[model samples]
Target: MTTYASGKIQTRWATLDDLPALKTLINRSIDALQVGFLSPEQIIASHAVMGLDTQLVEDGSYLVAEYDGVLAGCGGWSKRATLYGGDHSRDLRDPLLLDPERDPARIRAMYTDPDFTRKGIGRLLLQQCEQAAADNGFKTAELMATLSGEPLYIASGYHPLERVEAIGNGANVPLIRMQKILQP
Candidate 1:
């Protein structure tokens, strides 16, 4: 489903057809946006820690933001047990569904194209994900945020829940676990 169109930017559910572009956008975002916020080693580790969770696309929960038809950002909410990490992450994969009343919705794989930073793409994706989760009966949402992404999630009302690290290529990557109550 398509959501709010502000100027030339639009949001919609992502599909397998968009996978190639999404992968490119995600890699570019990780490469260009993680600088300063992450040590070079951490950035390398990030590649193993973050990426496209195709299940989100299959579940039809992932949303992509486009600026004049160019993919600018992507994110999604999930009912699955996994809290974060992409399909390729070395972490355990859990496809089990979560009960809306018992588990907070998982906000997975949020990324904004570096060229599109400060353009409201991330905010737009967050709004869409939160609203969709709420509509599906989830009362709260949680995400694993990179240092660079913490500011935006904080501004959007998510609070830190914990600090965790993902290890890859012998590099330690820090991540913040954050949550927010979804407004009814």
Candidate 2:
């Protein structure tokens, strides 16, 4: 766990118990934060592409950020083959474990509560995820960056490798594939 600035911020591994709150926060974040970055139709399609991946929680690899003891943000690194999207979004779920030496650890399901934006909650959760991945022997980390989240990923040392579209609900949402080498 980490604490910042007189205990205003804290971070810890997410548990199954956090699912309800996590779902609410994830939906809220997608609806509010994607406003300018996506067309109305694209935003609606985003719901089909982004959300909590229960596998992360089950793997004990997900982290949740808290501000004043309330959930502020969430994100986590994964050792599995899947790179992004909720379980409902994909039919061929790759549950295979990734080799840390070869596959980049996946940074999945990042979301910040709108009320907690600009409070470093995203940064806090991201830092934790990278560290956790490094500790597990991962040499690199990768994420599917939403149009609204690209800035943050770029600023955090991830470089864009490709721009792709997630197609669903008859709309296409743009996403950036980004990667970062973990500092030893």
Candidate 3:
């Protein structure tokens, strides 16, 4: 569909046809930005073996931003009976979402083309993820946000549940587990 942008752009629900391009864009972005944070092996494993293309295919939330029909950015989630923290007390305002058995949808992959960086594409993809989670009956959404993406997630309404050091490439990388309660 047509989208408003400085140039020709499109925003639409990702289909099977978009998977290959989306996967390539996500992998390229991660490799460019996450070299110090994620191991090369980890990056390849996550993107090649499992990512938005493979993981979010079965009843999971997935979206794409296209510039002149080229895949520019994407974000998505997958439902889980449990999450990292555990069930919110049915509260949107005061939620205690869990990581395990917490009725959450996991927001996993989000990426934008370097050429499209600083544009609103990332924000749009993130908001689309939230809406998809809510529509899928999730009371909340959660993600292990990267350092660069954390601020954007926070600005978009996600709150930090905990911050921990993740061992990657035999180095400690800070990871923030965050949640965003969705309105029913």
Candidate 4:
């Protein structure tokens, strides 16, 4: 837990019980922040491809940031092959376990509430995820970042690897793939 200008920010592993609030927070954050870069349809479509991945909660890797008792942000890192997707992904694939010795830990589903933007909540959650990943023996991290989220990832030392179109709801949404070397 940390204190910021907004209030007390607390982070903890998300549980299945956190799903309802997490989903609401994520969708709200995405809709509010991505409007400038994405169309309404595109944003709605993205939900099908990008939303809460319950598996993260099951793995105890998903985290939620609360500001004075309110959901402010959420994110997590995965030790599996799935890079990005939500519960509603069309092309369902088994989450292949990754070899932490060689594979990059995946940073997944990062979202910050609009009211808490720039208040350091996202950064705090990200730091926690990175530290946890490193502690698990991962040397590097990767993620598919929304345009609105690219800045935060870059500011945190992630470098762009490629720009790709994620097919969501029959629409092509531009997303950037980024990677970062985790420091010991």
TM-score of 2: 0.95
Backbone clash count for every predicted candidate, in the order shown? 0, 0, 10, 0
Candidate 4 TM-score versus the reference: 0.93
Order of candidates by TM-score, top first? Answer: 1, 2, 4, 3
Q: Which tens-of-lDDT digit does each residue in 77-164 have in candidate 3? A: 6664322221111221122343433567777667887667777788877777777677767788888777667888999889999997
TM-score of every candidate relative to the true structure: 0.97, 0.95, 0.71, 0.93
Clashing pairs in 2: none
lDDT top scorer: 1
lDDT of 4 by residue, 1-184 (tens): 2233434888888989999999999888878999899998888878877888899999999988888888899999999888998888837434999998999999999999898898898888888899899999999999999998889989999999999998777888889999999987
Cα RMSD (Å) per model? 1.0, 1.6, 7.5, 2.5
In angstroms, the error of model 4 at 184 is: 1.5
- Against the hidden true structure, what lDDT does model 2 obtain? 0.90
Assess each prediction's global lDDT (C-alpha) against the native: 0.91, 0.90, 0.64, 0.88
Leading candidate by TM-score: 1
